[model samples]
Target: MKYEADSPEAYIDLLPEDRQEPIRRLRKCILSNLPEGFEETMSYGMIGYVVPHSKYPAGYHCNPELPLPFLNIASQKNFIAFYHSGIYADPELKAWFVEAYRERVPTKLDMGKSCIRFKKPEHIPYELLGALCRKISVSDWIQLYEEKISR
Candidate 1:
């Protein structure tokens, strides 16, 4: 995929009806709590919240145009995915995510380096997920990637 969404609204509109609700709910949860420097856009075929690489310029994998994104939630063709970079970016957050996922999700969900997949809105723990989304301030996220590369 080209990884482009015209706007958050348009992106959700593209998804199927069943997909729309979960995406909408997730979008609401994320947008309501994002940090100041973070931006929401459609990227990678999903709703990407970019943590502009400029604010935390010292530790980007590439150019400074990139930002530290905490979560990238997208309504895929088959499922709704909640990508939380914090799990891999910060160890403490990873542990917390594990505990939260186990305690709240209660499903044998698959995981990527930082992505957590769920089939629907009911699968997500709104409050815990909201808290997770809120924790990734631009500064903390930048420090997270910096700490990653330094290792």
Candidate 2:
């Protein structure tokens, strides 16, 4: 199934009923915690939120019209996936995330390179995840992108 959201907020609205709860939880987590000036929109057939404006000054995308590092919440599939930019921030953060998950990695989850795919909302450690989000600064976020893309 094609993953599509008319607007970032509407993206959550369009999700299958079963997938809505976790997506809501994840969305709430990101919105409440991510730094201000982060713009929200739909990109790459996914719901995306970006720091600063989506176009002006530009982010890493072939087309400036569409936001890069699309953070997706898919209803067709039953899991929450964090797209680029948010993932692979720092090796230490990455290591910290992986290690943290290892302690309670759900058997039902499946993941990609930088995504933590989980079917259930309960599987996520809200405190741990939110703390991680709060911990990183904008400068640190820039460093994350540089390290991730420089390679």
Candidate 3:
């Protein structure tokens, strides 16, 4: 579901009461473990963690005016979605996450290239997500973005 909000707080407020807490926890997990320099904002209608234009002057390759997005979390129609650009860009990172997720969670992983969908909020693995957040730093993301995604 696409929510129209100006800020992360507003986005959370717009979610259903049942979804708010899980999204809040997910947001906290990302913020607590995410390395320095990524800024939180509303990007593509979700709560986005991004490399601000101040840090990456060229901004996002698709749209230069917007910040370069690193991660995003959203409450979707059928599930909660956690999007991490690093896993999509880095094969080694993706493999590590896939293996780690299997070790930590009993359920089958419902994942796309960058989006991991949690059908049941209770099944959302906060610890694994936090570790994933820490796996890439701002400079490292910029380098990977340029090399693999931005072209």
Clashes of each: 6, 0, 0
lDDT of 1: 0.73
Report the error of model 2 at residue 139, Å: 2.9
Give the top-scoring candidate (lDDT). Answer: 3
lDDT of 2 by residue, 78-115 (tens): 55666544455556766676677667655543556657
- Candidate 3 residues 24-64, lDDT tens each? 99999999999999999999999999999899999998999
Q: Output the worst ten-in-a-row residue range by lDDT, candidate 2.
A: 67-76
Predictions in order: lDDT:
0.73, 0.60, 0.97
* Candidate 2 root-mean-square deviation in Å: 3.1
lDDT of 2: 0.60
Best model per TM-score: 3
TM-score of 2: 0.75
Error of 2 at 125 (Å): 2.7
**Model 2 spans > 4 angstroms off:** 54-56, 64-71, 76-78, 84-86, 104-109
Q: Candidate 2 has which clashing residue pairs, if any?
A: none
